[model samples]
Target: MTDISTSDVQHLAQLSSLQLDDHEVEALRVDLGNILGYIDQLSELNTEGVEPTYQVTDLQNVWRDDVIDNYDLGRDELLALAPDADSNQIKVPKVL
Candidate 1:
């Protein structure tokens, strides 16, 4: 079993910028000890030949060939539709 002392709790509180009261320090000492004991128990597990899994879901990438579109309107026809047009291009207001 882990033995978390009052001094250890105080030190941790200082490092974390916490101002713990006497009661809070005592309470955390017991709680931290219990947490460490539980973690120590997990160290007894045996997994000698288990494969490491990165992801649990069975997913694959679905890809398709890229295709270029040829709309009926040419550059000149598109520029005519714009509110303002410059030399073979649409004009927009300048932003800072």
Candidate 2:
């Protein structure tokens, strides 16, 4: 079992640029110790003969055939749909 000292907690706070009070530092020391202990426990588990998994499910590329369909429409026909138009051109409000 590893022990987390108050100084270690303070150093961590300094590294993270955190302003920790006395109570907060004490709480952080205990929390960090518990996290380290859990990680140590995980280190003891046997991982021999185990394949490192990259993905859980079968990876498949889902793709569809690209098809292009052109609609036959004149410039005047498109300009008529706009709310505002100027001399055969559609005009909108200035963005900026």
Candidate 3:
């Protein structure tokens, strides 16, 4: 089993900005130790001949050419649709 000290748990809580009580701190100390022990057990597994798996779904991204379709609307025609327009640009009320 991993040895997780009280100070270690307290330090972790401080780093995470957590306000843990004494009971919660103690509980987390044990849990953290158990997690580390499990990781240690996994480190002992034989994976010398195993291949690393990246994507399990075997799916790939289907990409299409980016074609701009303006629907036959010219710049002036689109600007005319806006409530306000000046200097070939749409104008709106100040947001801030």
Candidate 4:
């Protein structure tokens, strides 16, 4: 069994910025310990010369052709509906 304790779980929660009650912390400790134990057991397996699998799905080039969407909208007509405008142009406060 993993040597995980309630204090360890509390410390982990603190590090992760999680707020947990005493009961929640206790449950998390047991759950996390089980997970850690499982990982430790897997680590004992001989993986020498075994190919590491990054993803199970086959790799493919899923791409789309580049295209321009040209909508001929008049600049003056669009600018006219603005809440504020200056000299045939839409004006807003400088962001920077």
Best by lDDT: 3
Cα lDDT computed for each candidate against the true fold: 0.88, 0.88, 0.93, 0.86
Off by over 4 Å in 1: 45-96
How far is 45's C-alpha from truth in model 2 (Å)?
Answer: 5.5
Q: In model 2, what lDDT does residue 7 have?
A: 99
Candidate 3 regions exceeding 4 Å error are 45-96
Pick by TM-score: which candidate is best?
Answer: 4
Q: Give candidates' CA RMSD values in order.
A: 15.2, 13.4, 11.4, 10.1
* Model 4, runs deviating above 4 Å: 14-17, 65-96
Q: Give me the runs in candidate 2 sitting further than 4 Å from their true place.
A: 45-96
In candidate 2, what are the lDDT values of residues 1-96, reduced to their tens digit? 469999999999999999999999999899999889878887778999998988777867767668754468878888889999999888889989
Q: Write the per-residue lDDT of candidate 4 for residues 1-96, one digit (tens) a residue.
A: 587888899899999999999999988988888889888978778999999988777867767668755467777878889999989877899989
What TM-score would you give candidate 2 relative to the actual structure?
0.44
> Against the true structure, candidate 2 has what lDDT?
0.88
Assess the local accuracy of residue 64 in candidate 1 as a C-alpha lDDT between 0 and 100: 56
**For model 3, how does the per-residue alpha-carbon lDDT over 1-96 read when each residue is reduced to its tens digit?**
699999999999999999999999999999999999888987878999899998889679977689998889899998999999999999999999
Model 1 local distance difference test score: 0.88
List model 1 lDDT by residue over 1-96, tens digit each: 599999999999999999999999999999999999889986788868988788878876756568766557678887899999989878889977
| Model 4 whole-model lDDT (C-alpha atoms) | 0.86
Q: What is the alpha-carbon lDDT for the whole of candidate 3?
A: 0.93
